[model samples]
Target: MSRPALPELSLLMVDDAVKAALLEDFGRAGDITSQATIPTDAKATGVIAARQAGVLAGIDLALSAFRQVDPSLDVSVLAQDGDKLEPGTIVARIYGPARSLLTAERVALNFLSHLSGVASATNAFQRKITHTNATVVCTRKTTPGLRSFEKYAVRCGGGMNHRFGLDDAILIKDNHIAVAGGVIPAIKSARAFAGHLVRIEVEVDTLEQLKDALTAKPDVVMLDNMGPELLKQAVKINKGQAVLEASGNVTLSTIQAIAEAGVDIISTGWITHSAPVLDLGLDIEIG
Candidate 1:
């Protein structure tokens, strides 16, 4: 089946990241093994193949790595991001100088496999709550340098993105409430400091806090660690006042119940932080 159209990520957007990864792999010595063993003129064809079932992502970024290593390398993308693949799927074809292909293989696979893993994991959560109104959203818990790429992968897997960073939105967590004396004070402080355009979301751990947050009239209220029963009551109390988000201790076994409790968004960190890397291999055919 054809893949759905996803937003185009320009090479410029990922160039720095790809370059940093290549630099880390190459160091100052370069691919010494390839230089010593392979003939400089040798050419080869290679395939990026999946070893297991997954949702494909980061094909372009992977290609960028090869291009950065050798601009003359030819890469033909067979599958775009967001496409579901069975085991042994060929994602892309590469033909290039054997030395360049060998040098870029690991760095390319690192980006492709890790982002595909995030996409696949996010897809699993998205599939679970297909019947519900709750949207699966990713949290700020992501690889330090790859948040944008990881969030893009989440979108590819049909998951929504929460705040990109603390600067973009105001989320009053438990610590903020504690420091400010209460939820209302925290929300008020945020409102006073933030511009009218900034959105204020307060996180509450109990019904009492929820009531206080409701009184503050923040843009959104996150129901932290609330079970299904409390979430239902919170939903009813909210009465369409603010967007309700359910978070904390969320897992595949419990997401459905949380979603059924009528929250607008369900946020989880595992999709970005703990997703296992997808198994993708690059096999080269020497010519």
Candidate 2:
């Protein structure tokens, strides 16, 4: 099956992150083993290939690691982000000074494998609910410094990102509701404080709370942990007045039912926070 290409994330988006990672790995002396074992002028070729099947993401991040580690290294990408991968798929190629290549190896693989995992997980989860119009979305539960990269991976895997951060939108969760005394007040306060451009989404755990929250006319309402049956009722009660987001208990096994219940958005944290890393390896050929 042909899959459409996703927008490319420019290398600049992840430049600093890549540099930081490489710097952290380099430490004070930088690749001491490589420095000792390999001569500075020694040349080597490398092929980064997938050892397991998965989707591709974070090509730019991987490139950033290589380019930042040694600007003189020659690097080229064989597969772009969002592309499907199989065991033995060639992701990229690098030819450069042996020491530089060895120095950059782990950092490059780390970014590619982790982000690909996020994309792969999201793809699998979204496929479970393809029959329904429910959109697969990622929550804020992301690695602290890697939120943007992980969210970008979510998009690559055919899922949507909820909100980048608290500044982008107002999401009133259970704690906020409790602190404000009720859902309505929490949403109302969020609405009043936010400007005309900001969107407000309130979280509710029960039908009565859903009803009360609707009265405030927030942009979206999150149905927290409601089973399929309650979700169906919430859909009927909502009547398309607001975007209904079904969160909690979202897994590959439960996603289909959640989508069938008629919610517009199915948001989960597992895709980003708990995704396993895709296995990739750097095979070096010494000259």
Candidate 3:
């Protein structure tokens, strides 16, 4: 079935990069295997089905990629972003020239599967927090050239996104701490040089450093690698003076306990960096 036109679509730079990569993969010619095996004008229809339960993401971009190959290719979305899907659920439908569909198959599935994986991981992390005002967030730990897409997927799965880049926000981490001699100097330099609108966050590993960070009065304090009890104590010390973010070695199993520690934000690197690709496949219907 032909899907209705998507009214408004925002294109991130990552989307453009993905489209470029797809074009590069296709080259002046298309998939030679599909071209050799399938007749040029043969028509086909298929469903992109999920193989496991997951929060759906990237179908819109996948649809866009398919259309880029052939405007005549029909795409119908059976599910939207953030929707939970069971195995065998048809997330999308495509009807078009068999050759074009086959040619675009890998690119389409690659983006869809990876993005859905990110969304699924974010959803799992969010599920861990039982009772807390803290929000789960994703870090700069994202796939190269795909950061925007991955962050978008994180949002789809109910997680917040940190600064998209160094330009957007000033985050002083441990390395910066060492380079500047300590958290105070790093915070001082960032605060002095940063524009009035810029917000600075400093990461600290110890309560003593937390004290130093507090003196600097940063916009946020990142509690790195602290256990649950220590995190709660850190929260108590902050006393709402600065926003609190917990990071380092976060996992789904430990997130709820972390959130309950009263931190304002939890950032995980694994959700985008190491999330397993969601299982998806395009099955063609022979008629």
Q: Indicate whether candidate 2 or candidate 3 has the larger lDDT.
A: 2
Candidate lDDT scores, in order, read 0.93, 0.91, 0.87
In candidate 2, what residue range of length 10 has the lowest lDDT sum? 4-13
- Candidate 1 local lDDT, residue 43: 91
Best by lDDT: 1
Q: Candidates' TM-scores?
A: 0.96, 0.95, 0.93
lDDT of 3 by residue, 58-123 (tens): 876788778777889998899987788889989998999988888788888898999899989988
List residue ranges in candidate 1 displaced over 4 A.
1-5
Task: Please give the distance, in angstroms, between residue 127's alpha carbon in candidate 3 and its true position after superposition.
Answer: 0.9
Instruction: By TM-score, rank the candidates, best first.
Output: 1, 2, 3
Winner on TM-score between 1 and 2 is: 1
List candidate 2 stretches off by more than 4 Å.
1-13
TM-score of candidate 3 against the unseen true structure: 0.93
Cα deviation of 142, candidate 2, in Å: 0.9
Model 3 spans > 4 angstroms off: 1-9, 12-15
